[model samples]
Target: MNSFSKLRFRQSIFAKFTFSFIIVGLIPLLALSYISLNTFSNYLERYAVTNFEQMLLFASKNVDDLYTRYNNESKLMYSYGTNKGQILGETIAAQTLEGDYRLTRTVDDFLQTVLYTDRHLQSVFFVFPNGAYQTVTKQNRTFDFRYQFPDREWGEVLQQNRNLLSYFPTHLDNYYLGSNQQVLTFGRNLLNVVNAPGVEGEIVGSLYMDVSMGAFDEIFQQMMLNSKDVVYVLDQNNRILYSSDRASIGQTYVQKDSNEYYRMQKDNANVAWKIVGELYKDELVMRTRKIINTIAIVVGLCIVSLILVAIWFSRRFSKPIRSITREMAKVESGNFDTQVTVQTADELGLLSRGFNKMVVRLQSYIEEVYVAQIKQKHAELNALKNQIRPHYLYNTLEVIRMSAVANDDNEVGDMILSLSHQLKYVLDYGQETVALQEEKTNIEQYFRLMELRYGEHKLSMDFRFEGDVLSCSLPKLSIQPIVENAIYHGIMPKSGKGTIRITAEELADNLLCVTVDDDGVGMTEETLHQVRQKLESSYSLDSGGSSIGLKNVHDRIVTLYGPDYGLEINSTKHIGTSVRMVIPLGEVNASAERHNS
Candidate 1:
């Protein structure tokens, strides 16, 4: 039964290979062909839509520019009152008997001479609030002089209506050689008398543009021939005012009084005007079908040719490829012992040889990494020992000091307790800095112990803490070594009791200030200056007695805080000595400091 199962499994390989090959090959071919078709279609569709939006903006800008030009001209005309910026300033004595025709004639003379010759302009008109009007046609034709006021001339449209700007029904059948023309009429209300007071103010003119749809249609036709796109022109309300396809013009592009995005406008509302462009969906669909057909033909022929070559090479390629794949599988599974055994003299053989060498190198690297990890663990263990053992010693000493207290040796016990407290403060904060208050306390405790040991050694302590200064932190051993320097060099060498006064205060502008003053056997001017200069500058603490005397405090401050915060010294010979420090002030929150760092 076992041998029968082995025979059946061997047959299953051929069946699996046929099924897997069909699936892998066909799925990619079909999906890739579809993607190619859709990609081209989408690109063209988006390209046309983008072009349409740009065209919309361009047309809107043109209208705005034209309106601004006309408005500026009226401003120049209004300035005629005092000839502030006018070419010809005139004052009329009478309002009515001065004659409406006279003012119309004056404006007409300028329009005919300056405006009628311009190419883009179609017409210019002057409208009086009395409903009398005059116009000059820019078109290349002649007509009756009285026909210049086309009855629907802007003044007559607002004869009884007081709208600032209005669009009214008008006949163009008798004008323009009896041809029907759709016109977009824009108007501005002008005063009849420049700077007139109250009801005396009259409509001067309605400067308007009656845009012929034929001009835009011509431009649209040219565009449609060159690029398969549609463009729509919109008014301030985003209503479709014009379209490349004449049929879509005058239709509502977006619904009115609708809140839904799809039901509302897609573009901005404050815009003076807009142009919207898009390609036809049928054009995109047609292109997609062409793309799919082209891909289908190309892929079918490619597969037919590749399959013929694949059949011939399949048996020949399988042996080496299968061997390489198996070797890579071992590498993936982290079995570096498996070596590729192919003996070809081509690039494939070179790759196999390189891979084998890489596996050997990887094995060596793994072994070295294991050894390094063991060494790292050993170093970490030693560092932890260094950090914890000092604290244990301090705790033991504290226990001894308490025991002495129980034995009723008050003087001995108190001295022991001071030393023990100082030791614990130092050891418990071995790798950390302590507050300025704690540093002073530790220094005082050390002083008590020293004084206890030497009965004749008398010293007076004068320490004062000002507001917000005592809370500032300093290195744990900062004050201790300085105190030791005084005891050894200055205080001890002196003949009588010495005074050690330490003061901590905050400067008015938020700075930490520490001063340690000692009236012991102070050095001469030259020596004191040298000490100050040396402590201010940087040098190694492992240098000399100078280093032990001052560099310890300097290095600790600079290393923990920064260079700006190192020790500063000032002194006068035999008068006294002071060591000062200014460090960045912060309450030590252990976790926050570590996280920020």
Candidate 2:
């Protein structure tokens, strides 16, 4: 390995931080991006499957509806006479007029009446067992000698399967000379309907209705030609009932081998036919590829940028500490007066100050070793207290700064009083705890400042307390961070007016629960999961910009109470979010402990 690689391999803080930061940061980001893409792909596929199935179902229903109309027409024709045998008893030979057989005329008129009644019926025919037949078309009428049906196979099949409705494929019938056209046939047995006691009725003849295929041609064409999806309607025998590829019609589909395809089926009960839709996956993914690729590229660039930033910051931080190390090395060699100077007000500056104090302390230790322990303890306690006071003071001054900016434009002095009340509450740290009512008042003043800053009507709040739960004491500012998160991160980002509802209730075993619910653009599941994970673990301000406020609130609650008490986040996308705070109901301090004991 090169010298640089060897140096990075060592357990140096700079190399470890840089490497760990990049690995810890980029892995989850990349993994999450990959998972999200796959999730979206699955979602799209499911959506497409639903839409295709619905369309196929609709097409099947349409075909069924058409078939039902014709089926019902056949039933209507069978019920032509009031008596069961009235219509079927009339024989063609019996219709004699003026000593000339008027059988041809009587049969022709009967068939023509049926053809003309329904526009879809192209032709009609009836054939009896007595070697006589009559047929009628929309444009012509014909009487024929018993020639038997042209499709003799189907004819024999129909006779064998008597009294049942049967469907026929597209075919040319030469029964009429001038009226030969392609038509779909629906035929059934015409039997004597009369019920005579102890007598069996005989079959009179067979009735056939030839429907023009042109009626359904338009429907099938519209379904296929308008969309890129492929559709196929199949019969019970798996024959192509209708297809976008007209040539494929009448061909059987035996589950052809193909990948990246989805199939959906529907049954047209009226016709006893099945409809199948074969949708190709390529057609679906083509439209979504651009979006997926864009997201992948963006995520990749983000990871690269994060890695570069980690490297730059790690180097920047290590350089100053290396300088401090060298100065400490000089002090190790009996240079008690040595001091390191750092101007910036950061950890490095604090380290330099400590280093300076340590050098002075070591020099004093040589002269007064007996008092060193006492002096060091006192100095450490005073230093910690001093550090805490400034941080609290800085937060108070920030609120005052915001209030002062608003005070310049308003004539009313209510803003100043609210800021004063907030300032006084922070400065008066004589007690580490406060009454529940005083904390509520402090929250009210903070809300007033927020209202003036954002203007009225942008946000609203409703507070509810169940049975004196508000009387219980809580740490000062425990609820303020939660309320602030609801406004800034939750409600403020929404498009419409937002409402936040805060409710306090007393639970069993001296536990108090406060919940804040907001009407806002709620978090996505991934975001909610991330936030919950942060709340359950150690809270860090450096996690992200938006989660900082929530983490602070959760950490404070958990720190004051036990691990069982903290904040819980529940959210649904586009609906809203609810944050519940659980804590013990009392002041959290030594004095409260003493009083209870």
Candidate 3:
């Protein structure tokens, strides 16, 4: 039955290996496939939008360049008559009704030169302040002589702001008779150039140039990648100046449905116009579908292949592991002689060999080290028992003595009882740590004995413990020795009554600081220096005067906690002495609990 149980355990391990391997391989593959599909679609959409934005930027740049060219040509026309000894502004300023025909011929010839330079120019008109105008057109079209300049909106804008250039959105060429071509117009007030310095010139007339929509058509057609894609050129008010849909021209461009298309716009820097492009979403989906399908098929194949490989690998991997497991079971059942056969030089075989070596060493350790430690512990306990016997005998004798003395002097009897208690505490070798309250009780008894031995008024003891500090743990006899030093060396040498203040408080960084301060005579600087040096030295064997007890307490504290914790002595000659001991609260408590256990 045991063998069958072991066999079932090994089979369960094999099954677990296969299942874990499948899960580990399958989850990431499925996640990657899902991520790849979504990532490819997002990437395609982003790529299309970026291309559309770049195309609109190029179209806007082209439109800006076209506007700049026409602006420069208009300036050239304004300053053309300079070579004729007078500018066009001056000629228009000097116009009269009788000489208007000759002025018209000259202005028409100058404007014709600019009209023929670009085939997109529809017409150029120079309208004088008196409401008369000279016009030229690409086609030899007649002009509307009845049209008045000062009454028109664009004309009035130029007349009011003599230095302003005005631009108009697409409208029918109404200045030319029987003409219906859609054209964008530019109107600028022509200023007479003043030869004298710091003199402002007055407006002579206004120059108006009209450009056909065919100029923007060429730009849009070159950038369009699909027939469904639409482009619009909009003025500052969002009204369409030109669009792929001719009917939408001159109307406010409403935003297209975002779900069906990707839209981008670029603003022209030279003009208050923007180029907008809308690309169909169907094109982006069509481009990403093929990549997504390919990824799906590849991921499916990888998952299928991973399952077959996992099953085969788990079977091979479990055989050697089963042999090791059976040997481990034997070891668990107290058969340390058991060994596993290493069939290969791989890591599993190394594990089998290491297992056999570990068992040999464990058996050797139990025989050689473990048994010897137990024997040593027994011997030490016997020694401690032997030492406790003498103390027990001494305490019994002292108790007999105290009982006999109690019949006469009760004070002396009580002091004898306190001495017995102190001896018991000092002699007990079992506990290395005691609580603050226990140590405090021991100190109170010692002071009681001192008070009874000497006059009660000679030495006054005060203990101040802050907030549960009496429950904190410290090494046994840690404070008692220092109190003994203060009494003998500090208080006894003083002339009058002396005070010993013992305070225990929790300091920062999990430290417990206990200060034994006395108003007795303090040491001189040189003697205090020597005493501090003795306390700091680890190997100092100076059993000199009162420092003996101080050094012992300091050494014990330093040994238990690290070197960072120890006694610090501050003294002034003929004034007082204070000895401060800082110890780690956590380590002392832990040590006390460990020793008790």
Candidate 4:
């Protein structure tokens, strides 16, 4: 059964087409569903966390504003009293001296009025320096007068920092009997106003305000999205002052498991506390899972329908393809006379007609275009070889002439050697481009020959090249012809010693410019114009004048590269002549290197 299945997959177009349609349709559907699900989940998670952070920030701000209002009220005890211009602090201080029941009743009434202003305030206490205290409460609870003010740690802290307010963490109300309510406390010492200069006032007594956790609960209730959401208000030491879960209050808030929840936190601006919110992760995943399952079901239905359609289409099309395949096999065996019969007037018929036409044209092109190109290439190569032979013969004769002229001169032997090297380079048809350094060496050899020939003319040469310019590539024998022209036309005609400066430098747009300047007899403006006109023209008859070498160099540059690159000439009659040649740099060098390799 497995072998039969493999044979069906290999030979039957219907089976192959069905499998291809299934893969092409099913894989992308699965991949797209997976990607979309992940993307939606991530976006949903980020959006939820961002909203949670904003809610936490709003809650923190509300908590800060509440604490700030209470802190300001605590300072109001130092304000001047409503009666007789006496400060409230001084009145509270005088209660220590009066020791009367009516005065104690008046003070208690004032504290009760302050407590009634905010429903969150649970109790207020004013403890005197002698450990005697007065208190008020929201409910009728008996006071614990036996609780000594000087004995508690919070009392000592307030007594030490007389001018600053101190905060106490969440604790039960121990100062009142039968009151087990949780409260956050603030305490400060009241100071005696000093009228005499340099007389520091003493501490009359300390004031304490107790705030209930209902204040935090009311603010957090508005921000809860669901019951499963957790909110916590923590002190600087990570101790929970208030939480949605009441059992966790007064305990340290350890971080929940991060993989199962999204948590956000903000710090209260008015106090050293942090507000935190956590949301469940499974809720977000459930939403994404439903979308993914729907997509998967849709994709499965599409795959099954696609397989049925592919089977019908493949059966209809495979017969025409099989006929074309048989004819193509005949063509592969060099039977160009074969043709496919047009079975239907659809694309299959058009393909059959196109195949017949293509075979006929292919046969004709093999006889005409292919054979002619080969013959033309052979003819050109042979003509080039014939032209190189005469130049080789001429260089050989020149070497012999030099040897015959000065046999005793040691420099003549060296000249012959240089000539032979020049002949070999000139005849090397395999390499069309050479490195700039090799061309420079060839110019030096040519200049040596000139020096030997014109012994009394006193010709000198100098080369200045920029960084790595010598490693660049140019057409072989390109510079030597120009250098020879400069020596003959520019230097030989001058009256005094002549100096030739050759400079190579890089230019913009990946170009290289090589300039040859000679301090010799230069051309008049009219002559220079004529020379430029001849170089710029597309065709010119050979005149064998002094500018022939210049024209040759210009033609080779323009032919190899485009017309935008060529030789440029500038000359002053009394001063010198400058011939600048521009050529492309990096790409040309790479092409030349590839050809050589």
Candidate 5:
């Protein structure tokens, strides 16, 4: 062991700092630099190839979704458009414009419905051979067709391109917002023939649908997190489809490949679609170098001081009993203000300060450990109480008092009734949870009774809930007490109408949130700050609400669902107050409903 220790030679401050700076600074920069250049280049190559494959896959799915939506919407547009044409034809056949305005209102209504379905769609217009046109869609803010407007774009395209399906690349349009047309436009040829429908010379018109490129742009935005990374859409010839920066659109780039990134990418033809990402490895090494340099500079001076100390230490050790006694005497009287001002930066000076810090840390650690143990004991005791003793007795007593209600035993019944209500709440226990819908119902009944006792001057309750949210289970009586507090204390004290709106939303996480809000007198900053401090300090129900009632709800939520699911309160002056509970999608015991009042 001695030999091994000596193998690592005694390091001076200069040497130690050199090593430390290299370790902390130089290593990271170099590592990151290598990653950014070589490793990332290689990764990008592989990514490009893989993404090329993915692009095809994504395209297939995207095509299907787009086609289905477009086809459905287009068909509706065409059917209504064709019906208008037929009605117009029939009107002309019967010579009915002076008398043929029968289908005019129908045509107008159909066009309006088509226009209203999607806002982004520019227009759905019909063209005729005589260069006259009939457009039925709301093109912009303007309503109806541009009559006798020359059909140039659609007209020329129909003559040349015979394919029923055609796609146009990104191009600007001539109208208002449409002029800066960032769209993928689809044009299908519409035909009109005598008796049998024919898309011939009488190519009556076409269906025009423009889809915004915002979604594609959004996809690029999502992928490009770092400035070094870029997402590009390309045509078959590697011409750019679009870049986030408009200037880069239609431009091309030669990808730089490094490491296995290139090797992996070259073979995988679909790499373009995979979106391989890159990292700068050399930065870590470079950073390490910088740190080593700084440490060397600082430690070089420390080493010189250490050498001076070592020389002094050898000369001074024997004459130290009196000095040690004096230092100890200063320390004993609670004096950290005194310094151990010996002529050396060696053993005794280090030992003195080191011992002081050790004492501080030891005392702190002991206190922390003691507090933690107490908390654990309390939590275990609470858990034991949480699981034991159902609230069935309270439910039974309520039924007993109800029977007394039938027998007209008012005196004893009233006493039992009061106790039963209190017991039922206690017996339900803070650890228990009930269905959200059930709790709402219970709270509604409780609030209604409270209102009856207090009168309408207290507050207005805006209890609006969707039936869909009713099935969600929550801790029992969670909402009632919060509302009761607002009425008895917050709103009832104020003159104006205080509104409480209890709302629920099914969150994407599959958890449910119930928010109870009131527009009462609200609270001062002092109270809110107190609440925040209390929550941070300890896990107790004693922070917000009317103290006891809110404490009960908070305790019940936490016990039933763990720490993550609990109460949050927010309030504004004269505006309102809100209490929200986030409950997990978990099962409740069958006895919850049976034991309810």
Candidate 6:
């Protein structure tokens, strides 16, 4: 029964392969050729659509550029009047026919400069509030409005439209052109820079600019590179203002044909202009059909030959490929010991060798590179543990301090407590810096411990912090070392009671100045010079055996802030020693770790 079932399964596999080979070898060629042709046709349609849309966008931009320039020309005149406090000197409302010709001459010169500088400007006119008007034209510097339109009707129209940039519907041909051609008029209410009677930003007059339709002809010519393409400029009402087809001008463009077409339109309601472009889809399809047919024929032949080769290749290729596939699956499952056996010296055999080599290399990489990195990380953790070894001492001291407190040896308890607190603050390798207040608290605790160790009368201390000095930040244990040096070296060696004063004060240029001063047996000039040389040199100092001293403190400050922030010591033989530290007045939530060597 098992043998019969196996025989039937083999037969089913052969049947499936035969059906698949037939479909893949022959049917796909015809089906794909048909599909490719349809796909090509669809692509051609999209290409046409995209091209027309881009053309319309270009046309819109060109027209917009022209309109923007025209608007800016008139707006420049308005802007000048508003900015300069006058057209030339006199106000727009102040300028009149009855006024001196100087005002008119200045205004004419200004407008003439406008016409000369901007080639797109055809004319500029200012209609005063008193029904009087002045004009500057590009026709010539000598010619004025009267030379072009020798009538009061134009002036009256301009005067009536005082508050708006009116767009005139009439053609410029009657007034300025010898033939009938459409023109657009853009006008705006002119404003004064400094209003009379103290009313600033007041409307004073009207300004008008004319844009000829001839400018758009160049744009249309550029867009109509293909004979089948159509372009139109429409008003807000969809009435054609300009078209590539002369007959289509003033007529509505209706898309009614069954043939494929691409359409694009850009509309600006503020200017009431719409640029529309259309391309015939038949043109694109006709252009691509020959190429499509050629490719289809070549692809069909290639597919037929490839299918025949594929059948023979599949029979021979299946075994090694299956073996490689299984090995690769094992590799994907993280079994890097899996290896492919090279069966032949062909490309597949070379691939199998490469695959086996990759697995071996992967296993070696895991053992070498990854394991080394993990061990390096462990070493770093160990180093961190070594750096924080002081924490162990701190914990032991904490236990001793608690025991002293329990045994009612209150002074010993206090001393142990302060020592523990100081240890905890100093040995904390977690942060790189601390606030001035925290450092001050730690210093006070240290001072208390010192006073408890040495009688307070024998060594007294004073702290004075001025003007927000506590908000600033510095390296941890920065101030405490200076205070320790002052107490031990400066004050402890004195005969009578000595005073140690620590002051933190705000200084000029965003600097916080911390001074540790003591009235003790001051150092001799030679000793002071040696101390200064020690501070200036790369020598390290030790305080109370374990604590870092002046040089380390100075170098840490300089490292954390800058060179300008380190210690400066000044002393005289019989006078007290003063060590000043200057650092920038900014706060950061950081603490000192291991200092950079």
Q: Could you tell me every candidate's TM-score relative to the true structure?
A: 0.38, 0.45, 0.43, 0.44, 0.32, 0.39
Q: Is candidate 2 or candidate 3 better by TM-score?
A: 2
* Error in Å for residue 301 of model 3: 10
lDDT by residue for model 2 (405-464), tens: 676834234566577667666654334455566667887887888877776778888888
Off by over 4 Å in 3: 1-35, 95-101, 144-151, 174-178, 195-200, 225-228, 257-263, 279-283, 290-597
Better of 3 and 6 by lDDT: 3
Best by lDDT: 3
Count clashing residue pairs in model 2. 0
- TM-score of model 2 vs. true structure: 0.45
The candidate, 2 or 3, that scores higher on lDDT is 3
RMSD of each: 23.0, 18.5, 22.1, 20.2, 25.2, 23.9
Which sequence of candidate numbers ranks them by lDDT, best first? 3, 4, 2, 6, 1, 5
Tell me how candidate 2 scores on lDDT.
Answer: 0.70
TM-score of structure candidate 5: 0.32
Between prediction 1 and prediction 5, which has the larger lDDT?
A: 1
Top candidate, metric TM-score: 2
* Candidate 6 deviation (Cα RMSD): 23.9
Indicate whether candidate 1 or candidate 3 has the larger lDDT: 3
- Give the per-residue lDDT of model 4 (tens digit) for 345-369: 3345546666776666656656777
* Tens digits of per-residue lDDT for model 6, 1-597: 699987775665344564577677667677877887889877876776776687778778888787676666666654455233555324544554356556666566667766666555577776665656677766553433335442355556555755445555424344544434455566766656554454245566666665566667777666544667778877766777777765676666676354555666798544778887767767766677777878878987887677766666555566677788889899899888777876564345545666676676666657677777567556655654554466567778889988988998989989988888787676653456767887888988999898898887888888899977786877778888888888887778888889988899888898888898999777778887877777777644533232248888888887887776688888766568898888887765422211110
Show where candidate 6 strays beyond 4 Å.
Answer: 1-27, 54-66, 81-85, 95-98, 125-161, 169-174, 177-182, 191-205, 213-225, 246-261, 290-597
Instruction: Enumerate residue pairs that collide in model 2.
Output: none
Candidate 6 TM-score, C-alpha based: 0.39
